[model samples]
Target: MADNTAAKIEADASEIITSPRVEVGTRGVNRVDTVYASIMDAMSNGEFPESGRLPTETELAQRFGVSRPTVREALSRLRLDGLIASRRGSGSFVLRRPDRNIKRFAPIESLADVQRCFAYRIALESAAAGLAAELRTPRDLDEIARALEHLDRVREQGTLGVDEDLQFHLAIVRASQNIFFVTALEMVGDQMRVAMQLSRSLSLERSKVRREVVQAEHREIVNAIDKGSSVEAAEAMRLHLGNARRRLFEGPQSE
Candidate 1:
């Protein structure tokens, strides 16, 4: 499996090298975005190894004719977006395929702005999930449960569940017993609404399987909190948000 994947990746590299090359950093494009897009395209082409082992940083740098730091930055974004996972001694590996049929949406703000919001939420909400696990009352759990129930009903009614989705996140933060966290999120409510609207709209257009995956992610966070595991709760929230970003921006479109 590893050898097969390596050969596929090498083939991709050869194609890129032989193709008419555009100069990097041309027309104000970022080198990191170039490298990131290249990898994503390769993933879309099914070039990843079965063992999920990605090429080393040094190899990727050479393959893309960019510096190691550029490749590193691209990989970091991929990691945060939950497409890949990096281990200290073992290197990075693919977690899943990029969705190929994602319908594009015009962002309410710049795509960069929406992505920046996701970055902030990943940090803030993950922490909130952790604290909620440690400090939640039965009431807090009830609030979260209620929000989730609303999400299901809206989903069943053929409506976009954006408000329910937002409330579910808010309930988790409120469970943290930290008014400041709640305050911080409320201050950014408009941004969150925009982000949620865009993301949920995208999900609504995709397959039922895709929408269920989103719901499953919400359940994972709640289950971790129910178990009172701070570490798992935080990690679940991180993965959920990261996956959400990927689903909104990187997910495959309909066939």
Candidate 2:
């Protein structure tokens, strides 16, 4: 009750401070964009994550001395970019992240070379999973949720066509918030796509495997991050990725 009243007052104050009308050719920059930058910076630095809850729209309006509409506009941008998520009654929470890796590769000739490729990647990616737990932003977590949801939908409705094996892991790399890491992973996407198509055909059971287990791996990665355990996150990633690689190489007798 008290929070609501305070919020209303703040909103009203913000409206008064921000004029409704704007000049057709104003030269100055937007104040709301400045507010937006600060809010993003705050999230980027893990301030909101450490605090454990973001301020209400009105609280933010009060803080930035901007209209409620202006603050909403800024938040809306964040929401669209997969940075923040909203709930009806409860406030938003930061999403968990899987570890990621940062390594570039030269073009490979065949699946044999990809074996070493996956081996080297899992090592760094698992550790990255741990860092993601420690450093995941709200946006990062949101992306994870969206990916898992997509995976489930795909699993229920159809397969990732035995070709999109990289979709789920790609989402994980993005969650790591390391641009270099995600780009490095992208480099081998072509080889991975080919390997996946081949692996699926070899192991007819691959498509039938319940995604519940794969989704479970995602949760495990998130759990490690939620607990702030980087070491555990990395080990889990190593084990998970190793399993994936084994399937690729030692998979049911391939041509």
Candidate 3:
């Protein structure tokens, strides 16, 4: 009887594995997101009790037919988002469903939306930069410097460097040492990424001279922060964002 029950469980698991594949590779849809969604669905369906622990990473990889690395990545994201918790000796366990009350910006469907996002950033990020200049510690400076170095490398490779650019900005916000500022940015994380992508695409189409100018502006902001000049840092950030807005909207007119 025990052998029959084990066989039935394996058969059910096989049915799940062979069902229609989730669309995982499209734009904005990554393997981690796919796996995260699958786990959430299972939890919602009562496959796992509220206090029940999740299966081992190896088991998850086998069930998803994905590499262990991919499974680990999904779990990490879940942990970061507060959907799961891990114990040192024990495995991971569900914490709770993701909070639905977090405010998210609408998807950027047009250039106008991107501009709106920039406008919002100008207000919040400028203040954050000022505070960061005043409050940043050595560790904060190191993180910001690392992000800037990454941006420099990506730019040298002639890529858009969208991710690096976002990282640089986020590092600055984190350096502010203000939890509210960081939380505000995290709430709009998706919209911020889309805005950066659109802005980078437009920037890439401009002359290399324009790109250099923008890079110089980034350096100015960092310099002000390094010198602990709050006013200068804030003004530099404002100017940089304002220039970005104009370059995206009013670049050399087409013939």
Candidate 4:
């Protein structure tokens, strides 16, 4: 039985090791970031083996058509995000599989786009959250609560939960009962979706304590809105987004 099991494991590893390479482009984009994103998407799509082991640095570099230094830098970022870990003799391995169901949105091409998206969301969503606090009905509160509940459940499953997060924000906007707020969100729906996905992806890569902190931030906004404190709700929303921005771009220490 032991010999048979060993043979099966070897076979599985061999098959996974020979999987197709993912090539990334270099047109007006950061190569390291593009390589990292490509690897992440490949993993999420089950291109990697169930054993969690990753291809060697040389193999990855060749596959991505970039320099070994570029691949190393990309891998370093993945390590910092806690998505993969290195073993002295065994190479690097993935820690978890990203949610496969995530729909492809407009790719976040650069750090500048990330910064601009967060800034726009902070101004737009905070206002909506504040208005919801002042003008929400029980039904509006219920929608927000349901969305929050969905987010918590998905988090427990260790997924990014982008859809649930977006729904929570949309619920608040709906509660505000202002057509303009809803319209504005819809106008940039694709960008907002990508931003939410990126933020949640980072959150998933961090510690459990960090994840809980994000959830707590969501609850704070909900509680303030429930109490009809527009000022408190707006402040909570602004602070939450600010911290999210810091966590993503400025590092966890900044948050």
Best candidate (score: lDDT): 1
Q: Is candidate 1 or candidate 2 better by lDDT?
A: 1
TM-score winner, 3 or 4:
4
Candidate 1, residue 28: lDDT: 72
Ranked by lDDT from best down, the candidates are 1, 4, 3, 2
lDDT (tens digit, per residue) of candidate 4 on 11-38: 5445435533433465655677777778
User: How close is each model in CA RMSD to the real structure?
Assistant: 11.2, 21.1, 20.2, 16.4
Greater TM-score among 1 and 2 belongs to: 1
Cα distance off (Å), candidate 4, residue 234:
0.4
Q: In model 1, which regions exceed 4 Å deviation?
A: 1-104, 251-255
| Steric clash pairs (candidate 4) | none
Per-model lDDT:
0.76, 0.56, 0.69, 0.73
Question: How should the candidates be ordered by TM-score, best one leading?
Answer: 1, 4, 3, 2
What is the alpha-carbon RMSD of candidate 4 to the true structure?
A: 16.4
lDDT of 2 by residue, 87-180 (tens): 8886654331101110111221233345545644664476467667667878777766666667567567655444334665676677677888
TM-scores of the candidates in the order shown: 0.63, 0.49, 0.56, 0.57
Candidate 1 C-alpha lDDT tens digits along 1-255: 334433533454464356333336757776776777778667756797323788999999999898888888778777766678988899999877665433244422244356657877777787788889989999999999999889878777869877888889999999999999899888888888877877777777677888777888888999999989887788789789877787765554322
Off by over 4 Å in 4: 1-109, 250-255
Model 1: how far residue 41 lies from native, Å: 13
Per-residue CA lDDT of candidate 3, range 1-255, in tens? 334433533454464355343335647555655676677556545575456899999999889877777788667645643457899999999766421211122221243345546656766777788888989999999998898888888767778887898889899999999999898877877877876675576666656777788888998999989999877787788788877765543333310
